[model samples]
Target chain A: MSMINYASREINCKLVYYGPGLGGKTTNLEHIYGKVSPNTRGKMISLATETERTLFFDFLPVDLGTIRGFKTRFHLYTVPGQVYYNASRKLILKGVDGIVFVADSQIERMEANVESMQNLYDNMSEYGYDLTRIPFAIQYNKRDLPNAAPVKDLQASLNPGWPVEDAGQQKVVPDPAHPGENLVDRVSNEWIGHAPYLEAVAVRGDGVFDTLKLVSKMVLKTLS
Target chain B: MAGAASWSFSENDFKQIQQHLLAFLRDSNARCALLVDRTGQLVATVGDAPQFDSAAFASLTAADFSANDQLAKMIGEHEFASLVHQGQKESMFLADVAKRVILVVLFDQRTTLGLVKLKGKGAVESLTKIFEEMFNRVGAGPGGQAGPGGTPQKGLLEGAEDEIDKLFG
Candidate 1:
C-alpha cells in the first residue's frame, strides 16, 4: 500500500534491506549513512547485540531530489538476517514500498541466502504483496572477496527473469505471469525470480547508489 | 444541520493551517506530533528529531493499526479506536481523525497520558478544518471526477460507513 501525504506533497516509501546473517544488509546501510549528504539523510538507528547481529531493522530515511514537484523520500530499513527473527522481519516489512535483497556472495553462504529469500517471499505473501510485485532490487555483496559467485551464475540462479545483459540493455514483457513477476519483468524476466539483482561489495560501497537509483525510479513509476 | 452553516477549506487555507499546527505542536513542548493519513504516511510532523525516522514510524504504525482493524472485524469487536504501546523508555499513542488520518504521538514515559490525550484532541480539531479544505481541492482539481464508487465525498462517507460496520458488527 502506498502512502500519499497531500500536505507535504511528499511520498514516503519504505525500502527494506533483507538478506541472510552477515550478508551485509546493515553494513550496506552504514556505508550509505556515511556517503550520502548529511542534509538528505536522517539518523541511522540500529538495534544490534554486542557481537553486532541485527536485533531489529536499522532505519535511515533518505530524501532523493523531488519528482514531479514533490519531495521524494525513501525510508531505508534493514531486517534482522538471522533465520529465527522472521517475526521481526515481518514487522519491518509492514508498509514497505520496495526492497533491496543483499545476498552474500561467498560460496559457503548460498543455502542461507536462498533460505532467507524464501523467508522474504513467505513473509511478504502473508501481507498480500508478492515480493516480485513491489519495487525491489538485489545486491550480491562481497563481490570483491575470494570465492564470490560469478555475477553470471548468480543471475542465472537468482534472477532468472532478467539475465545479465550488456549494460543499458532494454527488454520488455507483456502479461507478466505472477504479480511479483511485474516488478521482476520491469527490468528483465531473466531476473524475474531473480529480478533486480546487482553485484557489489556493500562494505566498500560498490553499486550501492546504482541500486538506490533503480529502486527510486520504480517507486516514482509506481506512484504515477 | 443546514448547508448554509457548513464550513469549507481550500488548498491555500490548508497549507497555512498545517504550518500553524507544526508551530503549535512545537510550542506545546511536544517532542513530535505527526498528522498521518489512514495509510500512515506522515502528512506533517513537528519538533526536532531529525535523527528520528518519522516516516518509517508512521508507515509501520499505520500498518499495525490497519492490521488491528481487520482483527477487530474478524472477532465481532468494534473498529480499533486507538492503540498505546508502552515500553520501559518509549511510548507511542495512536489516535484516528475522521477515520481518515491517524495522529501518532511519540514521547518518553515522563509525559503523562492525560496530557498527550488533551493535546492530541486539540491537534485533531485543528486538523479537521484543514482536511475539509483538502477534500475541496481534490474535488475541484483537474477533471473534478469522483474517486471510485463516485465522488470523493461519497467515498469518504462510505469509508466512514465501513468503519462503523466493523466497529458495531
Candidate 2:
C-alpha cells in the first residue's frame, strides 16, 4: 500500500528486498544508503544476529525528491534471507508496494534461489497479493563470483515468464535495458511476461541504483 | 497488477486527529504521542518527543506491535491490544486504534503508567472512531480504491521518472 499524506505533502511507499540467505539483500540497501545524499535518507536500521546475519529486517527510508509538490518517500526493507526466518519475512511484507528479489547468481545457490522464489509466491498468495500483478523486479546478485551461473540458466530457473492472461498485454515487449531481449513473449500457446531483471555486484555498487531506479519507476508508473 | 490502495488524509482529517492527540497528551501528561499506521507509516505526532528518528521509530513500533501480536496468537490470545515498555528513565505505551493505527505515548518521571493507560483508553476510543469514519469516507477496505478527497492529484506522478533520473545523474 502507498500512503498519500496530504497533511505532510508526502507520498510513502514500501519496497521490500527479498532473496536467499547471503544473497546480498542487505548489501543492496547498504550501497544505496552509502551513495544517496544523507539529507535524503533516514536512519538505516538492521535487526541482525550477533554474527551480522539479518535476524528480522533492515529498513531505510529514502526521499526521492518531490513529484508535483508531494515528497515521494520509499521505505526500503530487506527481509532475513535464512529459511527459518520466514515469519519475519512475511511480517516485513505485510504492505509491500513493490518488491526486488535479489537472487544469488552463484551456481550452487540455485536451489536456494528457487526455494526462496517459491516461498515468496506462497507468502504473497497467503496475503491475498498476486505477485504477478505487482511491481516486481529481479536482481541477480553476486555476478562477480567465479562460480556465478550463466545469465540464461538463472533466467530459465528464476525469471521464466508468467502467463499473460490479459489480451491487451499479450504482445511481445522488448527489454529496454537489455537490447535484443524480450521481456514479454509468446511461449508455446500462451503469451508470457517475465519480471524485468538486471545483474548486480551489490558490494561493489554495480547496478545498485539501476535496480532501485527500475523498480521505483515501475511503482511510480502504477501511481501515474 | 495489484493496484495498491492509497491512504489519503485531507487537511481537515489531520487537524481532527491532532486535536485528539493534543488532548490525550494533556490528560496523560506523556512527553509525546505518535499516531502510526499498522503498516509502519507515521501518520501524526504530537507533544514534546525527544530527539530521535521518528520515521524509524514508527517502523520499529509497527514491527514490535506486529511481533507481539504473533506472540499473542501462539499463547492462544487473539492479540495484545496494548504494550508498555518501561525503561530506567522513560517508558513507552502503545495501543491499537480500530486495528488500523497505533497510538504510542512516550513518558518519563512526569507521569504514571496508570494515568497514561486510563487516558489512553479514552484516546484510543476517540481515535478509533475518527479512523472508522475516515475509512468509510475513503471507501477503504481490503484492496479498495481511493475515493473522492482521498485520491491523489491528477498527474501528480507524471514527471516522476525525470525527477528520479536527476537523483542519480
Candidate 3:
C-alpha cells in the first residue's frame, strides 16, 4: 500500500526485490545502499540466518527526491531467495506497491528463474495483486558472467506470459494509430512485462540504478 | 492505493495533530510516542530522544504487530488489544490507535506501566478522531483523491531543502 502521512507530509511506497537464490536480489539492494548518500537513506537491515543467507528479508528506505508537494519515500525490501522460504516470501508481498524480479542471467540458472517467477505469480494472486497490472519490472542480472544467457531468451523463459515470438504478424502487435516503425524499438514499448527490463550486473552496480529508476518511474506514474 | 493515490493533509491538519501528539507525550510521560501506519512507515512522533532511529523502530514495530496478528489467528482470537514489553527501567507500551494505525509509547523509570496505559487510551481516542477527520477531508477510499481542495505545493519543497542543509552539511 502507498501511504500518505498527514502528520509527516510525505508519501511512502513499498517496492520489493524478488528472484531465485543468489540471483542478485539482495545485491541489488546492497548496491543501492552503498551508492545513495547517507542523508538520503535510512539504515539497511538484513534478517539473515547463521550462514548469512537471508532468512527473512532485507529492507532499505530511500528518499527518491520529491514529486509534487509530497516527499517521495520508497521502502525497498528483498525476500529470501531460497525455495524453502516461500512462507516468508509471501509475507513480504503484503501491501507491495511495485516489484522488481532480479533474474539471474546465467545459462545454468535459467530454470531457477522460471520457477521463481511462477512462485511470484502464485504469491501475488494469493494477495489479490495481478502481476499483469502491477508496476512490475525485470532485471536480468549477473550479466558480467561468461555463461550469461542472452537477454532475449531469458525474457522468453522467465516471462512466458508475454509475447516473445519475433516472426510473422503475431510478432508485431503495433497500435493502429501510432504504428511502431520496427520490431526492436516496439519490443521495449508497452510489452515490457508491464514495466521495463534492464540488463544488470548488480554486484558491480551496473544497471542497478537503471532498474530502480524504471520501477520508480512506473510506481510514480501509477500514483499520478 | 491500487486506484488513484488518495490521501492528503493541509498545514492546519499537521498543526492539529502535533498538538495532540505533544499533549499525549506530556500526559504519558514517555520518552517518545510514535504513530505508525500498519505498513511500517512512521506517521508522526513527539518527544525528545535523539538516540533512537525512529525509522528502523517503526519498521520493526510494524512487523512485530503483524507477526502477532498471525499468531492471534492461529490461537482463534481476533487480535491482541495491546502489547507491553517491560524492561528493568524502560518499558514499552503499544496499542492500536485506529484499526489502521499503531501507537507506541516508550516510557522509563519516570513513569509506571499503568499510568502509561491509562494515558495512552485517551491519546488513541483523540488521535482516532483526528485521523478519521483528516482522511474524510481528503476522501480516503475509492476513487476520490485530494483533488481541488488539496494543499498547495509552494512551501513543501522548500521544507526539504532546508532540512537537507541542516542534516547533511
Candidate with top lDDT is: 2
Task: Give the deviation of candidate 1 from the true structure as CA RMSD.
Answer: 11.4
Ranking by TM-score: 2, 3, 1
Provide the overall lDDT of each model, using Cα atoms, as 2-decimal numbers: 0.66, 0.88, 0.75
Candidate 2 docks at the CAPRI level of: medium
Residue A96's lDDT within candidate 2 is 89
What is the DockQ (computed on Cα atoms) for candidate 2? 0.51
User: TM per model?
Assistant: 0.66, 0.94, 0.81
**Can you write out model 3's per-residue Cα lDDT over B60-93, one digit (the tens) per residue?**
7877777777778789999986899999987889
Q: Write model 2 residue lDDT over B53-129, tens digit each, in one string.
A: 99999999999999999999999999999999999999999999988789999999999999999999999999999
For candidate 1, lDDT tens digit of each residue in B33-66?
6766654456666665636566666656666777
When candidate 1 is compared with the true two-chain complex, its DockQ is 0.10
Off by over 4 Å in 2: B1-4, B139-150, B153-169
By DockQ, the better pick of 1 and 2 is 2
Cα-lDDT of candidate 1: 0.66
Second chain of candidate 2: TM-score?
Answer: 0.84
Docking class of 1: incorrect
TM-score-best of 1 and 3 = 3
Error of 3 at B73 (Å): 1.5
Q: iRMSD (Å) of candidate 3?
A: 7.1
